[model samples]
Target: MKKLHVVAAIIKKDDKILATQRGYGEFKGLWEFPGGKIEKGESKKEALIREIKEELNADIKIDKFALDLEWQYPNFYLYMSCYECSLESDLKLLEHMNGKWLGKDELDSVQWIEADIKVVNYLKENL
Candidate 1:
């Protein structure tokens, strides 16, 4: 099985978590944290910074590894790392169709990708 390693940002401000809606691909319109696949020779942190810049057009300071989850989908096995991140500005949705800062109680309001829904549930229980 091919391994897909992705870094996701858990950007929290005023107790709300930032979530993006995918604009294209297999998961288009589904909500997920802003991040992307690790490219060759890039460190996880480097991939994260690059991804956030590419996807959200905002600079982020990664604090720590918050969670790691294995997701088995019909097409791929995904290994995702969630990191606590602080954003420097309001995010611009460069690739996503929409974005929102959702409070814990409103997490279920948006339809999330299956893999990402696990992360949301985890956050609800722990954060």
Candidate 2:
């Protein structure tokens, strides 16, 4: 199976965390965290910052490691690292079908992509 390495930001403001819906691909309309693929030679944090800036036009400060997850789909294997992050500027979405800031009680309410559901589960247990 092919493998994909990515970083996802669990962006928090107060008790709320940010989520974004995919606007393209098989994951279209599925909610997930706000980061993306790590380019070759780019550290996870560096790729996270770049992905957030590209997708939402906002800056973030990653606070700490949240989750290191591996999930297998029919077509690909996901190797994802998640980080707890904080917004550094106003958000301007350039990609994504929708976005939301959800409190912990509302975290599991959204329909999350498979990989991100693990992050949500972690938040439920630990946050």
Candidate 3:
């Protein structure tokens, strides 16, 4: 199976965290943290910054490394790094299915992609 390294941002503001829905691919309609695959020549933070700009038209400062996980999907192995981030500008979604600001208590309202469950658990415990 192909292996992919990616970064995801947990943008927390006040009582809510940002979650994005997939607009395409097998995971369409599933919610995920805002981020994408790490491109060649890009560091994890760099890839996350670039992806946020492309997907949300917003900027963020990576506050800290949150967690990392490895998961095997049907066709690939996913190595994902998660970060706690602070948004620096207004968020405007230019890509993907949908987005929402979910409170810690409301995290389970939407269906999350398989890989994001652990991150969500961490958030619930700490936030």
- Candidate 2 residue 41 Cα shift, in angstroms, is 1.3
lDDT of 1 at 25: 98
Q: Model 2 shows how many backbone clashes? A: 0
Ten-residue segment with the worst summed lDDT in candidate 1?
84-93
lDDT of 3: 0.93
Q: Each model's number of backbone clashes?
A: 0, 0, 0
Provide the overall lDDT of each model, using Cα atoms, as 2-decimal numbers: 0.91, 0.92, 0.93
For model 1, the superposed segments whose C-alpha errors exceed 4 Å read none
Q: What is the lDDT of residue 107 in candidate 2?
A: 90
Check candidate 1 and list the clashing pairs.
Answer: none
Higher-ranked by lDDT: 1 or 2 = 2
TM-scores, all candidates, are: 0.95, 0.97, 0.97
RMSD of 1: 1.0
Candidate 1 C-alpha error for residue 122, in Å: 1.6
Pairwise lDDT winner, candidates 1 and 3: 3
- After best superposition, candidate 2 residue 25: deviation in angstroms? 0.8
Tell me the deviation in Å of residue 15 in model 2: 0.8
Better of 1 and 3 by TM-score: 3
Residue-by-residue lDDT tens digits, candidate 3, 32-94: 998999998999999999999999999999999999998899999999999999999998988
lDDT of 3 at 16: 91
